[model samples]
Target: MATNQEEVKLFGVVGSAFVHGVQIALKLKGIEYEFVEEDLANKSDLLLKFNPVYKKVPVFVHNEKPISESNVILEYIDETWKQNPILPSDPYQKALVRFWSKFIQDKIVASFSKAVRAFNDEKEREKNIAEASEALKILENELKEKFFGGEEIGCVDIAAVFVAFTIPLIQEVAGFEFFTAGKFPKLYKWSKEFLNHSIVKEIVPAREPTLVYFKARYELLVSASK
Candidate 1:
């Protein structure tokens, strides 16, 4: 990776797991780049031009060619840098990694988000709790080693970073016991190690402000439900 010739920049918002994934990848690869924070409330012209289809945050621009979607950006970074390889070299293992990564996005995130918002509705809360628990159990079984991709924090770990980062906040706001160690031991242990990772610790936002924001959002959702 030639640093001097190429210009690298990241467009993202704070408190977004998707953006965090890209940032973490950049740090893992030891890639020096500029970060442009986008205000989602007021969509930026540059963000729109780069990601017109989704009109969303987390657009990774490498030499003025922007890559949309966090997973795509992760793949690009791994392929381009070739230093701290995130994905596995073996074809079958790589496929499995992608499967688990997509599973985190598709199966886990929806239920987790629902569980957070269901704080106001007892029945809905329980339903999402059960769903989330089941999903987490599957992940627990998959993480036979230290991380999703063995001992090293790899691409699958990057995909599931939200679980390590935001789940505790949701647990606090919902007053739920979903992520208890007594329940999902492996998943809980993985989360602790994931958060404790040197590079990962650097990217997490301060808990106080994150709590303030999530608390307000929880109250708003509760009120709207009523």
Candidate 2:
């Protein structure tokens, strides 16, 4: 557990799914921290200084030390807090967890983003959607339990925050179906289980505003693609 003298702060934007993962990990660990909301249009000096390389949201600061990347921050929190541990203790299990987390970030998220960006081109959009669906199928096969970490939520579950929440929202905004219950039943069920968890419910952005935000952003992307 963190001491009273220890200070923790999260630098992120409200709508970022990557940022949400860090927030969920902090809450799960029962850590008390200040949330500094950043405006991406007008980046904050602290965020830039802390994450000079990416200059991105979701920079986690602990006792004046800054940590960039959501997955790295999640591991750090699990190691530091020790209570309600996010990653497994067994070496093999821990390695598996890390593997799935990286797969989600590199494979699943990347394909989904490409599909979303291929908005104006029909052939390109369908090709990207097929690629994204293929990636999701692999995840569906990997999920044999209620959550990615078996009965309990773990690092991989937190890593998939974007898949559970944001992808569905993007599907809604874009008027397409990539992560549907019919196509990927296991993944669909897992999404429900993950989203309905009390901690996740607390941190997820409200539906209406989040949809509106995505809709506006999607329009801009489509306009740019023209």
Candidate 3:
């Protein structure tokens, strides 16, 4: 294969924050690629084949080789494209950026999931939501200027995107609030701007389908906890 733009393919799961985050990065870099939607429930052969170890979506295929993990794929896309750079070139800045991204992935994302999973248990759910909000406040104060990337979208912004795009829908389904204008003014404002960012605006998954999927999933989890 000659390896034109179309040769770059991404295996994605619908309504997935990780998948959507990578897609947002690709669009930011002005990269053209095919997006293959994977049914995570059924576990597609293509996904399993490309990401055998994790057996997950968000496998970026370039020249027939697959890159697993959204953040790793994001850096790969930035390095390969060399336009609209995602990570800061300065070593210290780059390290700082990576630290925030890692924080989002390891700490924030898991908190959101735990909070959602505890929907049926009000006390557990409230505690988790409070912890998540405290964690978010760190990001809120970190936004000294326009984005996590300063004036442009960057790696940290991409990594913490779930807080901007998905949490509202999760709030709707779980009947709890974390990212709110009252509680996190800066983060709430960032969410609005993030959703309206030229590339991000276009790629946010449809609100209806996302709400439907999350609502159904939440119901299943809640029922199971009973």
Candidate 4:
């Protein structure tokens, strides 16, 4: 299929938080791409073919070359498009962005488990909360300025926004709130501004639908635990 610009096809569900990162990055770069929604529960043959290792969503296939992992896809989108760039030109600055992105991904695992499963032990619950808090603190410091790096919405800003937006909904489902603005004032402010961005606003899923998604995931998680 010929695209107005060279065709770029992205495979993932709209509500997948990682997919949202790619969607926002592509929009920011003003890239024209076709979105193919995948049924994660069903495990599409295309996804399995493209990413055999993880077999996950948020797969970016550019002219048939497949790229998995959201952060990798973000980098690929920015580098390929070269229009509204996502990463900084400086090396040190770029490293800073990667640092936060990795941090967010790491904490996300623990947070997801905490959000989905029932914690019978107070010790385990405390451990999960501590892990989440540590991650949020790093974000708070990174967003001390108006942006993750400065006045503009850069790669780090976009990467962290996925966590900020999704974390609240996860908290809602878990019946716990770990992201207190009081504890992480800078991150809170940055999240408010990032979510308020016109591009961000356009792509953000409605809260109700997000909550429903979380509830469904939580149920599956609970069942898996049993």
Number of the top lDDT candidate:
2
**Tens-place lDDT digits, model 4, residues 1-226:** 2356576889988666788888888888777788898887798888899999999988999888999998899888777777878898789977877877877877854565573454456677777778778877766765657887577788887777656688778778777777767888777777888888889888878889888988888777767777
Q: Tens digits of per-residue lDDT for model 2 on 62-179? A: 9999999999999999999899999999999999999989999888998889878876678988887888888889988999899988898889999999999899999998888788
The CA root-mean-square deviation of candidate 2, after full C-alpha superposition on the true structure, stands at 1.1
Model 4 residue runs over 4 Å out of place are 1-5, 108-115
Runs of candidate 3 exceeding 4 Å displacement:
1-6
Top TM-score hit? 2
Between prediction 1 and prediction 3, which has the larger lDDT? 1
TM-score of each: 0.93, 0.97, 0.93, 0.91
Tell me the whole-model lDDT of each prediction, alpha carbons only: 0.86, 0.91, 0.84, 0.78
lDDT of 3 by residue, 50-159 (tens): 99999987899987899998888988888788878999899999889878888887778888788888755778877877778778888788998778898988898898
Candidate 4 colliding pairs, count: 0
Instruction: Please give the lDDT score for candidate 4.
Output: 0.78
| Pairs in clash, predicted candidate 4 | none
Better of 1 and 2 by TM-score: 2
> Which residue pairs clash in candidate 3?
none
Clashes of each: 0, 0, 0, 0
